[model samples]
Target: MKKMIAVMSGLAMIMTVSSTVYADFGFATEPDEVAAVVQAYIDEKLPGKAVIEISEAGEVIVKINKTSFLNPNQQVNILTENLRSYLLSNDADYSIVRVVYDEEATQPAEPTGPEEPAEPEEPAEPEEPAEPEEPTEPEKPAELVDPEKPEEPEKPTESTEPVEPENPAEPAKTIKPGDLDSSGTIDVTDLTEVSLALLGDRNLTDDQLKAADVDGDGTLSLADLAKLRQYLSKKIDSLD
Candidate 1:
């Protein structure tokens, strides 16, 4: 009788612990339709022990019971990245997401094993070649060039007053085809120069960088970089 009472007490405690730990979710999807997709994704990206519980949350299907088939002793950053990629690829519309992790009850779940770099996602079969983007129609810069190219200055004209070199007839806007950085125009020869300058393989004059940054977010992140290359490519091809 005493043993039975002890077992019942333990089961009651377990139920209370589970109820306190389980979190609610707001995401939605047809559970049966995407269950396989979600399961497959979990199996591949997470090789070790991790928990993935998929079920209906009220009207929506979800994996509210976040656990691991792999040991939960994994790097949080790596786990976050894997989760972000999974969410972004399959369901971009559902950006409003909440990831509730149990701090007290959770383990430092990191993959103890060596990690393989994620494989590149296969590109969707091209229905047609991608449409070419429109050119970057940038306004002409202010005239800073002199009318004529002066002979090289032999020495400083004045101790305090610096000599102003004569500018060419006009500022050259014609960029050669291989001028990737688009600073007044450097070519493959400028690759090293650029790399040395700001860690880019090609140098970018202030003007070129401004033109490349369409959103003006003051960042050369992947999106801005892609736009910059696209603009230069369009202009170069047009010249041909």
Candidate 2:
């Protein structure tokens, strides 16, 4: 039993030592290992000025301390090309973290106090304006009168005086004595009608007989026809 216990103690010591050494061989923290890698890159690429810093705040932070970094533009160029190649080749998981300077350490901020609230000013009271007086209406002037009385309008004259009507002209007579055919004169036509009546060759109307009688005799004969011919020859002035 004593021999077995001694062997068991020796085995446990060797296991503890081996595990400790193995852990030591590995990275202390992933961030520290990344910082170390970044530092080597800075030294190789940047040379004398820039460096990488690793620290623990609430968590491990890898920051680029650019306190004496000579060329920021050159460092930026290296980060884009060489740094990206390094991370990709090494399979680093720092794609999301933006590498920038730890400026909060170099420049300390001044302490400030809470500012006092400003007092509000009271609004001024508005003044009341005076009421305007009503405007007075001007008095109307007396109606103008003409000194001379206007001429009295002329009264319309009534047609009281009796109107004298003009005499009417007599109508023209359609028949004449000795005008046998009522041809408007005692001529050969009247004689010819009387001759025709004597011979009974033509019938004579009462007005024709009246026209055929040239001497104002009631009867029509050869004597009346001769008188008509004489009148036509202008031997008698009037056949009235």
Candidate 3:
């Protein structure tokens, strides 16, 4: 039964061949940095009847046949597990896998559409301006009085007694030292003048502010202020 031995040996050989081919390497995944290099290797080796899925999430799924016509174990260990390890070393975190079932090649769903940006709000219209205030009528002016009717000059006297020509009155210089502050008093306004003098602010308009600044050391300063205080103190004492 040399014939029986031959048949049995042949059967054993066939079964071993079948098991080598049909084993599985399981996962679903995406393309990563090493994706291109891995892909090139796979394309060169497996060629056809293989699928690669590269998800946007960076999951890499390499699906090969449960039955490769060529080196079958090579398809599982070296290609599948080594690829997973390479991706891990490069920074990919979680991943899943499954064998390529002879029945179906699962395709992940496509996203619907790009997200739309939000719109800006429209500005509200400004409220209309309020009505302008009404103007009031001015009061009537008082009638002018006749100076000729006063006792001082009811009429020109018919004087024949040598009405000597009256001398012309001199123009009045009304700016008094006390009037600098215009309070009709010689108090703080004069002191303020001294202060300005200390600051070199000598451009006084009324000449009143400058004149009250008696110490005229040219500029307004604490020196002038102190002088003013002393002058005022003396003046006040004299008033008693």
Candidate 4:
């Protein structure tokens, strides 16, 4: 009867410890009510060996503190599948339920030494500007002349004796009766001149008019032109 009492007492203690472990895990409750259901599921699979935490984005993180379960990786996968099925069955909004070992979660990052200081960069040299060219001086202006003191005029030389004026040219004398142009010949030119005079298209000189009056009436007319044409054609021997 004592053995039976101790066995029952021991079972009660195990139940109390399991309840304490589940309570100590403190599953997420404020941000998501579904977190309690997921925590309870993880507690049933891992018992007191796993902790449940919910991220701000409502992802379920199951950290296994003990690896005493056979095929821990397979167990994590099975637990993940079961939790995913439960969330799906309940139509919960949780998207991810990750299961990892405690060391993987709390492992310290490798220490990184300080980075070597970077070499100081040399400053670039400034370029010197080209020198400005000197300005050229302007040429001086010409001297101004005085208006009051004018220059003297040139002196005139002594005058010589007055020179005599040249005699006027002599008038041409009539060489012949038919030589009207004073060219020493009577030809078509004289005929043309006489014809132009008779037509009033030309003004003949005194010698030419005297010579052109072949009939000697002292006045030129068409009769003189006819007589002159007759003389030149040899029909009349004498122009007189």
Best by lDDT: 4
Candidate 2 lDDT, 40-70, residue by residue in tens: 6666665544445444442223344463455
TM-score for each predicted model, relative to the true structure: 0.20, 0.27, 0.22, 0.29
Residue 59 in model 3: shift from native, Å? 83
Clashing pairs in 2: none
lDDT of 2 at 13: 97
Please give the CA lDDT of all the candidate structures: 0.48, 0.64, 0.57, 0.74
Winning model by TM-score: 4
User: For residues 184-207, could you state the per-residue lDDT of candidate 3 as single tens digits?
Assistant: 676776676656655777556646
- Per-residue lDDT tens digits for candidate 1, residues 59-81, read 21222223544433444444555
TM-score of 3: 0.22
lDDT of residue 210 for candidate 3: 52
Q: What value does the lDDT take at residue 56 in candidate 2? A: 49
Q: Cα lDDT of model 4 overall?
A: 0.74
- TM-score of candidate 1 against the unseen true structure: 0.20
- Kindly indicate the candidate among 1 and 2 with the higher TM-score: 2
Pairs of residues clashing in candidate 4: none
